[model samples]
Target: MIRNEIKIKSEEGELFDKKQIALAIRNSTFEDDLKCSLLEDGILDKCQGCSLKYICNGIDQVVDSYMEKTTEIVNNFNFD
Candidate 1:
């Protein structure tokens, strides 16, 4: 049988509906907060010589661009 409702377990052991988790993540400040924390902890020094250092350096911008495009695509999707 196919299941219509899907659930995910959090690190805290709480069960949440997949849609609920998706919505929560979509509206969260996790990326910005993580960037702030990394900057505060001097992530640049830690990421020295890493191949993805350049991408990680501007992750906020990259995520913003990706989200913008994703939102546009979702908004333009044909749900009919």
Candidate 2:
């Protein structure tokens, strides 16, 4: 499954910071319990006030449970 998407509070073409979002993800115990589908669900739970808007921009993709392991976001990209 590919979580190759981004989320944001607005669509004003904001260039958010990835390090901050990464840090939040790392610090979030609940985030650790989240599935690998980072960009698929409502990240507001994880990225509440985050700055990594670009990472989830133009994101309308999804990866259901049937998602494969050799997919894009899970296999190719490493948000960690």
Candidate 3:
């Protein structure tokens, strides 16, 4: 459902505009989906008996951090 009219090139030889990229990213599914998939696949359980869980903010916090960083990137990315 993406519109084909969104096209802009940057000064450094970029072929797409930041706004267009942002819109495409905004419409994509991510963040929670990845978290759920990783959790369900037992990836988060790797920290169940880790000694550095507290120091590393635990697996849940790590996943939350990933989601936060993804959101930040999708919100602040630029073609430049």
Candidate 4:
């Protein structure tokens, strides 16, 4: 799924492209999947009990997957 067309940009500059991100998402292992699991799944929920949950936007595993390596060029990118 991950081709070689996407453009990856970091704060400094573009780091990767679309295809690369798709590859990473597809190659995710069980543990890797678990790391970003949602609160209902257990991962984020634990954060809720922890002190940092308040600030943590909670892992958006879905978005993590949906966007995976390719982020659509929204109207604005807030890198803050």
Model 1, span 1-80: residue lDDT tens: 54334565579875758665444445554443333445467765566676776866566565566577676433555678
List ranges where model 4 is wrong by over 4 Å: 1-15, 29-80
TM-score (C-alpha, index-matched) for candidate 4 = 0.25
Query: Model 3 lDDT vs. the true structure?
Result: 0.53
lDDT of 2 by residue, 1-80 (tens): 53323443357775556655554444343234334254456545664455665444312121221123223563565588
How many angstroms is residue 6 displaced in model 4 relative to the true structure, after the best TM-score fit? Answer: 9.1
Kindly indicate the candidate among 1 and 3 with the higher lDDT.
1
| Candidate models: Cα lDDT each | 0.56, 0.42, 0.53, 0.54
lDDT of 3 by residue, 5-45 (tens): 46755687647666664444444445322233445687676
Candidate 3 deviant stretches above 4 angstroms:
1-4, 9-15, 30-80
Better of 1 and 4 by lDDT: 1
Q: Which runs in model 2 stand beyond 4 Å of their true positions?
A: 1-13, 30-80
- Lowest summed lDDT across 10 adjacent residues in model 3 is found at 27-36
Q: Pick the candidate with the highest lDDT.
A: 1
